[model samples]
Target: MILRSPYPDVEIPEVPLPEFLFGAGFGDRGDAAAFIDGATGSSVTFDELTGMVTRIAAALHERGLRRGDVVALFAPNSPAWVAVFQGVLRANGIVTSANSLYSPAELAHQLTDSGATMLVTVSPFLDRATAAAAQAGLPDDAVVTLDPVDGRTSLVDLLGSSATPPELEVGPGDTAVLPYSSGTTGLAKGVVLTHRNLVANLLQFTPLGTTDETTRILAVLPFFHIYGMTVMMNHGLHRRATVVTMPRFDMAEFLRVVAEYRLNRLYIAPPVAVALAKHPLVDEHDLSCVDVIFSGAAPLDAELGHAVARRLGCVVLQGYGMTELSPVSHSMDERHPDDDLNGVGYAIPNVESKLVDPETGREVGPGERGELWVRGPNVMSGYLNNPSATAATLDADGFLHTGDVATVDERGFFRIVDRVKELIKYKGYQVPPAELEAVLLTHPGIADAAVIGVSDAEGEEVPKAFVVVQEGVTLTADDVMAFVAERLAPYKKVRVVEFLDAIPKSASGKILRKDLRARENA
Candidate 1:
C-alpha cells in the first residue's frame, strides 16, 4: 500500500544547483539582500552574492580544484558559509560538510573517509581544523579559513582572484554535496546528494507557499545540518527570501536577531520550541513579527508545540526526514494550519511512501505501525564508498528504508511512533549509540560499554551509557561520561552513566538494547 503525496507533483528542472539558483530569473532580485549576518547586521545583495560565488569559484579553479574533487566545509552558520558552499558547486567540485562541534578526531574521520582534497573552516576553529587536516594528510595550504588570519589562506584572498568562473561541468545527476549521517546504525557515512536531489527538493515544497520574497527567515540552526542546508539556506535563496545567519545559538542573540530583522519565518528543532514556550526571555522580545515556527530533525511533543504556538501567537508545525532522504520527505505546509501538529503532515510532492512491517516484510495499511520506506527525486544516490550500507537502506525498488516506524492515516498524514534504527537523537543531532560505545571501549577503566537513548528530566532524548568496569579498575559514572565527552562532540556526550556487571547480549553477540530500554523504563 504505497501512499502518494496529496499535492500535485512538481516538475523538477534538469539543471545543476548553481544554474538553478544563480542562473536565470534572478535579475529583479539582484538588488535584494540575499543573506544577512544576524549579529553584525552585514548583508550581501543577490548580485553581490553571485559575484562572490563567481570569484570564489574562479579562485578555487585556479588553485587546481577540479570536477568531483571534494572540499570539506567545517564551519558554523554564517553568510560566508553559504557563499563558500555555492561557490564550491559553481566551481564544479563536491562539498562534504562536517559538524561544527566535531572534535579533531571526529572531523579527521570525515575528512579521511570523504577523500576531501581541501578543508574550509573559520579562524576560531583553526586548532581543531589544523589538527584534523594533519591527521587526514592535508597540507597547511589546504586549510582555508573563512575569516582572515596571519599566515593563513582566507576567503578574502579567494574573492580577490581575477580569473573567469569555470563552465558548468556538473549536471543534475552529478553529485553535489556529501553530508554525513549515521543512517540506521554504525558510524557516520557520507550520504550522496546530487544536484537534482537538491533542486527537486526545492521545487517539491513549492506548493507549501511558506516563504517568498516577502519572507524574512531566521537561520539560527547550523547550516551544516541538512535541515538548515536545504530548508533554510537553499529554499530561502530559491524563493528570494532574505535569510539571516547566526553563527551559534544564544538565547538573547536569537531573540534580538529575530526582532531586529523582523524575521517572520523560523525553522527550528524541537528543543528550540521548549525555549520559545517556557523561557521568560522570550517574553522580553517583540516576536510579533514571527508568523510561523516549523520544527524538524526530531519529534516535537504536541503539548510543547501548542504551548509554543500559544506563547508566540504563531502557527507550529513539524516535518520528517533523514539525511538519506535529502532531508525532507514530509512537512506540514502553512496552508494546513488546521492539521494536527503532532503528525508530520502530508508527504511532499513527488514522494511515494510505504509503511512496511519490519519482521514480515509486508506492507501495512493506514493506521498500522511499520517502517517507513520513501521513494522520490530527493532521495540520496547512496552512501559514499559503502555499497553494503546503501543496499541495506535503499532497495532495488528505489525505496529508501528509513528504519523509522511510522503510521499513516487514510488522508496520508504520517506519525512517527518508534524506530527500528539504533541511532539516537540528542537535541536534534544524530548521536549513534554504536559510535559512543566504540569510544567508551577506549577508556582504560572500561571493559565493555553499551549506550542507548534515555529520556532526560526535560523529556529530551540523551545517550545513557552502561559500563562494565575492568577487574581491579576503579571508574565512576562521571569518569565514564567524561571519557566519551573528550572524544566526541558535545551533543554526543553521555549524560547518564550506570555501572553494569555485564551488558545483556543475544547469542549472536548483539547488544540487547531492548532489555536496556526496558531497564531504563523500569
Candidate 2:
C-alpha cells in the first residue's frame, strides 16, 4: 500500500541550492539576525551572512577549489561554519561535513573516503585536523582554520581576498553535501545529497514547521549531523528564523540559553528530551517561552514525550527519518498540535511512502508492521562510490529502502517500531527493542536504557538491557526486571540488566548498539 503526503505537494524549484536560498523568496530578510552565538550573543545578519559566503567563495576559488571538488568542514556549530558551508556550494564545490567529536583516525577515514581536497576547522581542533589531513594526503596549505592562527590560513585570510565570487556553474542535480551514514547497516558511507535533495526537503518540511521570521530556533545538536544540517541550519535560513548556535550541549548552558534568548522552537534528539523530562536542572530555568519541542534522530517513547510536554507545558513533536532521505520524510505538522506524540505524523509534501513486508517482499496495509520505503525528490541519489550498497538500498523505481520497521494507521500516521536487524527473536516470538526500551524508561528508577539481543547460556537469543539508573536512586537488577515484566509480555521482558555510567552515542544522538554488542562479546 502506497501512502502519499496528506498535504499538497510544493513545487520544487529547479535551481542550485545556493541560488534557491539566496534568490527571491528565502533571502530577502536582509538585516535580520540570521544566526546568534549562544555563548557570546554575537549575531550574523542575513546580508552579512551572504557577504561572508561571497568572500569565502571568492577566496576558495582563488585558491584552486573548482567544480566537483570536495571540502571537509570539521568545525563545530557556528556562524562561521555556516558561512563556509554555503561558500563552498557557491563556489561550485561539494561539502563533506565531519563530526566535531571525531578522533584523528575517524576523521582521517572520512577525509580519505570522501576524497576531500581541503579541510576547514578551528584552532582548538587544528592538531587533530592537521593529523587527519596529513593521513588523507592533503597538503598543509589545504588546511584552513575558521579562527585566526599564526602560520595558518584562517577565515580572516579567506575573506580578505579581493577576488569576486565565481560564477555559479552547478545545477539542481549537482552534488551539494556528503553527510556520512551507516544507512541500514555496515560501515559509515557518504550519502550523496544533491542540490535538489536539500532544496526539496526544505520546501517539503517548511509547511509543517510553523516557523517564520519571528521563530527562535535553538540549535544545540551538532550541525554535522544530517538532522541538524537540513532541519536546523538550512531550514532556519530558508524560513528566515533566528537560529541560536551552541558549539556543544550542556544541560545548564542549554537551559540558560533558551531562557535567556527566549527561544521558542527547540530541535533536539531523544537524549535531550530525557534531561528535560527528568533532570532537576530543567525546573531551574524559566522555560515558559518554549513553544514547541521537536525530537528526531531516534524513536522517542510516548510516555517520556508526554513527560517533557507536561513539564515544559509545550507541544512535543516527534518525526521519523534517516540520513539517506535527506534526513526528513515524515513529521508532525504544527497545525495539529494535539496529534499522537508516539507516531511521526503524515508524510511531508512531495513524499510517498510504502510499508512492505521485508521477509515476504509484499505490500502491507495500514496497522501492519513493514519496512518503510520512501520515494521523493528529497531522497538521496545514492552512496558515494558504493554501487553495491546503493543498489541494495535505492531501487530502480526510486524508493529508498529505509530498513526500519514501521506501521501506519488509517489516518496515515506512522509509528517506527525498530530496525529490522535489531529485533530480538525469543522462542520464535519477535520482540522489538524500542518497545521494551520505552517500557524501561517509564520506570522511575531508570534514567536511560538500551535493549539489545544477546545469546543466553542455552544458545537462545534473548533481550538484554543496558541501563543508566537515575542519580541518587537505588535500583537493583531484579527491580529493573520486575518493572519491565509488569509492563510487557514475557518474551519482551528484559532478561539481562547491566548498569553503566552512561550509554555510548554518536554525535547525532543514536545509541551505539554495536559498542554494547562488542562489550557483551568481550
Candidate 3:
C-alpha cells in the first residue's frame, strides 16, 4: 500500500547541475548576498559567486580535470567552500566531500574508495590530508590547499585568468556528487547522486517556504553532509538567499551570528534543538528575527521541539531522509504551520513511500510500524563501486529500502518509530558499529568487541562498546575509549565501554547487536 505525497508535483529540470543552478532565467538578485562568513563578516553576492564558480571551473579544466573525474573536498562550512563545490560541478567533475574531522585512515578509505585523484583541504587539515593522500597513493601535487602555503598549491593559484566555465558533455544522468554513507550497515560507501537527483530534490523542497531572496539562513550544518549540502548550501544559493556560514558550532557564537545577521531561518540537527530548549544561553540573545527552524538528520523530540518553538516564538519542525534520497523526502510545510510536530511531516512533492514488514516483505497498512521504502526522482543512482550492496538496497520495483521503521498516519504524515539498521546517530552523524568493531579488534588488548548505541541522558544515541579483552590484559574503559579517540573523529568515539567475557555472536560469526542492545536496556 504505497502512500503518495499530499502535495501536487512540480516540474524537475533535466539539465546538468551547473546549468540548472546558474542558468539565465534567474533575475537580478545578482547583487543580493549569497553567502556570508559568520566569523569575519565577509560577504559574497550572487553575481560574484557565479563569477568565482566559473573562474574556478575554468581553472580546474585548464589543470586537466575532466568530466567524471573525482575531486574531493575536505573543509568546514564557508562561502569559499560553496564556490569550490559548485566549481567542481561546473567543471563537470564529481565532488566527493569528506568530513573535516576524519582521521587519516578514515579519510584515506574514502579517497581510495571514491577514486578521487585530487584532494582540496584547508591549512589546518593539511598534515592529515597529506598523510591520507600518501596512504591513498595520490601524488603530492594532487593535494591542493584552500589558502596559499609555502609548499602546497593553493586554490587561488588554480583560479586562472579566464572566467569562462568549462564546456563538457554533461547529462542529467551524470554523477555530480559522491557523499559517503554507511547505508543500513557496514563501513561507509560513496552514495552516487546524479545531477537530476539533486536538482529534483531542490525543486521538491522549494515549496516548503524556506527559500527566497529575502531569506537569511544560518548555515551551521556541515556542507559535506548531504542534509547541509542540499538544504542549506544548494537551496539557499538557488533561491539567492544569504547564507551565514559557521565553521564550527559554538553555542554563543551561533547566537551572536543570529542576532547580528538577523537570520530568519535555521537549518540544524536535533542536538541544537536541545540547546535551544534547555540552554540559558538562548535567552541571552535576541532570536525574535528567526521565523522558522527546520531540524533534520535525526529525530527531534516533540516536547523539546514545542519548548524551543515557544521559547523563540518561531515555528519549529522536523524532516526525515537518508543520503540515498538526496537527503530529504518528508518535511513539514511552513505553509501549513499548524501540522503536528511529532511526525516528520508529509512527503515532499513527487515522493512516494510505503511501510513494509521487514520480515514478510509485504506492504503494511497506514499507522503500522514497518521499514520505510521510498521511490522518487530524488533517490540516488547507486552506491559507487558496490553493485551488490546497491542491488540489495534498491529493489527491481524502484523503491529504496530506507532501513528506518516508521508509520504513516491516515493523513499521510510519517513518524519514525525505530531503526532497523545498526548505524548509530550521534547528533545526526552516522557511526557504523562494524567500523568501530574493526577499530577495536586492532587494539592488542581486545580479543573481540561489539558496539551498539545506548541512549544518553540527553536522549541522544551514543556508541557504547561491549568488549572481550584478551586474557591477562587489564584494559580500562578509559583505555578502550582513548584508543578509539586517537583514530576516529570526536563524535565517532565510544562514550561507554563494558568489559565482557565474550561478545554474543551468531553461528555464522555475525555480531548479534540486538542482543547487546537488549542487555543495555536490561
**Which 10-residue span in candidate 1 carries the lowest summed lDDT?**
504-513
Off by over 4 Å in 1: 182-184, 422-522
Give the Cα-based TM-score of candidate 2 against the true structure: 0.98
Better of 1 and 3 by TM-score: 1
Q: Using TM-score as the measure, what is the rank order of every candidate, best first? A: 2, 1, 3
Can you write out model 1's per-residue Cα lDDT over 1-522, one digit (the tens) per residue? 889999999999899999999888477889999999998989999999999999999999999999999999999888999999999999999999998878899899999999999999998999999999999999999999999999988999999999998998999999999999832244779999999999999898878756889999989887887878998999999999999999887789999999989999998866566567666799899999999998887666676778789999999888888788878899887886888876888899999999999879999999887899999999999999999988998999999998888889988989876567767887788676756775675565666678889998999999999998877889888888877778888998999999899887522133667788889879
Could you tell me the lDDT of residue 330 within candidate 1? 94
| 110: Cα error in model 3, Å | 0.9
Better of 2 and 3 by lDDT: 2
Error in Å for residue 271 of model 3: 0.5
Compare the candidates by lDDT and give the number of the best one.
Answer: 2
Q: Is candidate 2 or candidate 3 better by TM-score?
A: 2
RMSD of 1: 10.2
Per-model TM values vs. the true structure: 0.83, 0.98, 0.82
